[model samples]
Target chain A: MKKLINGVDQIVSEMVEGLVAAHPDKLRAIENTNVIVRADAPVQGKVALISGGGSGHEPAHAGYVGEGLLDAAVSGEVFTSPTPDQVLEAIKAVDSGAGVLLIVKNYSGDVMNFDMAADLAEAEDITVKQVVIRDDVAISNPDDRRGVAGTTLVHMIAGAAAAEGKSLDEVEAIAQGVADNVRSMGVSLAPCTVPASGKPGFTLEENEMEIGTGIHGEQGVERRELMQADAVTEELVQHVLDDMHLNDGSEVALMINGQGATPLMELYIVARKAIQLLKDRGIHVKKTFVGEYMTSLEMTGCSVTILNLDEERKRLLLSGRE
Target chain B: MKKLINGVDQIVSEMVEGLVAAHPDKLRAIENTNVIVRADAPVQGKVALISGGGSGHEPAHAGYVGEGLLDAAVSGEVFTSPTPDQVLEAIKAVDSGAGVLLIVKNYSGDVMNFDMAADLAEAEDITVKQVVIRDDVAISNPDDRRGVAGTTLVHMIAGAAAAEGKSLDEVEAIAQGVADNVRSMGVSLAPCTVPASGKPGFTLEENEMEIGTGIHGEQGVERRELMQADAVTEELVQHVLDDMHLNDGSEVALMINGQGATPLMELYIVARKAIQLLKDRGIHVKKTFVGEYMTSLEMTGCSVTILNLDEERKRLLLSGRE
Candidate 1:
């Protein structure tokens, strides 16, 4: 695999160093740990928000750490959950008198590790709450669903609520509300190589694709000949709509998230079709985001996320720093 | 080559539609044209800024077309320059009595077309000025150096200057200063396919890379074995530093631009090395931007841009809408 990296073992640490170096005004790395926090963290009385998982999804948990988003993000090795110790460091570094909330994706590894971190933090007399996001609608069993790009929406709304000095319970409730209402589905045209493995997680023929692929290159629901962009986008959006049970006059926030290798040009193409499909169903798109918010390392594909927005959610979603 | 797109013929139009649709609050498309303008265009006393070129460089021109950025951007087909007529439409659509400034990359096609558009606008009594950016230090012959990712910095600075109610001449001077001081170099591990051609622009073995590759997939200065991220980043930054003649106490802004397919993790790795190299030479990086600012479809590599800065330029660069 032709990847731009040094030793595989140093990927996460080096990346965190580079990230903090590039944005010293906004982000800082905790010494000797894979934890990144807002440069001006631990506001004395504001609710602190923490979210993180694996390393490959750059700009996800860490990139979202700032004034109106996450307060701290603890990164693990690629496609692996962070140790509870790292998460606890993030919790301790960012938690002020107002308490801390953990916004986690629905992967079992992430859920377990973050919960352990929360338990550890509570033992130190810090109030902590947790919200698990299961926004991916691909799995037939809701409990088996994996959070994907829709977790970005949760980050924005909950972070905004927390930045507004909401109580820990209020922030947790807002985050959980987002997790309950958002849906996402993804397709992959190519697989990504883990730096350490030096092999693609999966493979597809030149003209084939995987529908409903998970972010970590998990087996998708189906393998089929690649279809046109509009057709692929239609399938993804239709699944989200069906699961959301939205009728006419519903308003929602739309996100067309690119896997690492997809070009922004193509993401916008997918966005066009997604907006058209949603409009045809008489659903009003309140806000739309089109870019790589969550990504698999070097994977070529896109995911469509629909967040059912209420008046309060819409207000908070639009209130963040650009 | 797999891509998320509909018919090749519809790629630019659909992408533009999606872009404008996704950002209705900030952008609008001129009716029946591939021209995107600020939603509140023709801001009558503020000098207008216009920039455009081939469409594959997503977010370069259009994504920068909001407040404190470009007043308008014209998009042509993939790897092809926008026609003078389309550029004229953009010029006419956004020009106010204060006049308009054209920011053109140093490519022959883009330079010729934007110049022609400026003439067309002048004929209509709308004052117009132009700045040609030739920031790529890859070509030994400075006259042949191609503009690359540094164009984004030009957009940010000149656009901010224009947004501050500067006259056309004043904005032109600032843009020209930026173009004159910036230097960039890139390396590509693989080539990207133009959608219309449906073939890779160039080929490379798994272990090879093209050093100093242009944004349009042009042949590079050298082909060599792929190297470690730090080594590759060092080579890129060294060339830029040599060409810029920066001193130990100098200050500048650094940009590590992803070509397309490179993950953000890898980009930050490159950024880490680039920043360290600059520091070792006692140069301070006043600002740093790391992401896919300028891209060449899905090419797997990155470019480094260094812009020598002064107090005025730094203020303008930091004064834009984020």
Candidate 2:
């Protein structure tokens, strides 16, 4: 495990400190907690948004904590869900008179903890709403799917709505709509190690890959011989397209997300194939994002996210924030 | 080597195609050339900026090609400089009546080819100016140091000047100033494989690292047992500090650039230590950037860049663009 961290126990705290230190004007950390909030959080009369998960996925929960995005982001241990207390702190730190919305990914631990945090918050007279994002289509059973990179779209669109001073209900509706309309699937060329474990969650032979892998290295649906970039992209995009069930003229936003270690060059190559695939099916890609929006430590792979877009969703997606 | 690429021959072109596809609103490729120009290039009365080098270092020249950045970015084969003719095409495509400026790295091939292209453009009556960025402080002999991640700062600061309607001379001078004031050093834990070669650029033992490695896996000044992130960061930052001779209370911008394969988590860990080291020296870090700006495929490492800042440079760095 040749990772560049000081120690296993300190990775999360140090990372939070480092992030706030780097962007002090934009973000700050809640005392004694792994909760990061916008520097000027708790804007009076504005719905506040919060999301987070394990610490390894950089720029996901915390990176999105700023104007036009998340109001607060809680951090757990790597690949571990945050405690309800941590999530509760995030809720308190960002909730203004308007209320708080928790955008949580659909991992069992995450769902339970965020829900518990919302309950805890509501008990204290804080209006808290929660939306579970289950956008990953890796499993045939949609109910069993894990949320993945499509959650980023939810943050962007819903965050914009909240920033525009939407009521808590309106923001929740926008978030749930995005969660319902988005789908994502990923392939991992390699696995990532949790800092405490110092060993990869899984392993593969030199010439093999795991398709439809979860961000936390959950067992993938299939392990196959390595294929060309186009073939792999085809498999992932086909799964997403089939699940979305869009007609020829369906318009959508596309995101090609790198799984930690993949190069931007390869992500672009993947994006090119994905766009071409969508065009062939008569799907219009209105907005395209290519980068590591969410990641699984230093795993080498990528995910494709497609969000069915309407006028409001498109407008909010493209809207700017301070 | 395990990589998500179509093939060695098509890697550069495909990557370029993919990049432009993902950002059509902001970038376009010159017909039949590997040059990517701002979608609305040749902005009359605004100095056009051009930068390029080997292809492996992505987002270096290309990703920076949007509003407030380079007017055009020329792509070369992986780790190989683009030919003078290719650069000449870039010069031709983005040169409005306001003239053009070429930002070339310190590599011999890049410097030679960009200079040749400038000469060719001058012959065609296009006012062409060039700035050769040599910001790496790894080698004690500054004249022989290779340019590293600091080139990205040159692009950001100088590119903004060009976008603000600065003349070729003004942009060239600002670029030259940035080039002179910036310094960088890097450490690599693992080497990346070139697509054509299908072999790691260099190798490291299971618990070893190379301090002061160049972007292309050039031999580092020191190779030793792997140390904690803080220790490694101290070595790199100390070298940069000593080279820059920044006084206590000096204001500057700092960047922690990932070398493709390092996780963002690790980069922030490194950033925390770097920031503390600078603060302890009374150096005031006005702005900090953390991510992969210029990458070497999938190398597992990072580089630290510090740019001495003045009022003009700080304002430009913070300025906005469409």
DockQ of each: 0.88, 0.83
- Number of the top-ranking candidate, with lDDT as the measure: 1
Going through the candidates in order, what is the number of backbone clashes in each?
Answer: 0, 0
Candidate 1 chain B lDDT trough over 10 residues, lowest sum: B313-322
Q: Which residue pairs in model 2 clash with each other?
A: none
Cand. 2 TM to true fold: 0.99
Model 2, residue A123: what's the lDDT?
95
RMSD of each: 0.9, 1.1
Task: Return the TM-score for each candidate structure.
Answer: 0.99, 0.99
Angstrom error of the Cα, residue A248, model 1: value is: 1.1
Indicate the fraction of true inter-chain contacts that candidate 1 also forms: 0.83
Give the TM-score of chain B in candidate 2. 0.98
Writing each residue's lDDT as its tens digit, candidate 2 over A220-266 gives 88999999999999999998988886998988999999999998999
Docking category for candidate 1? high
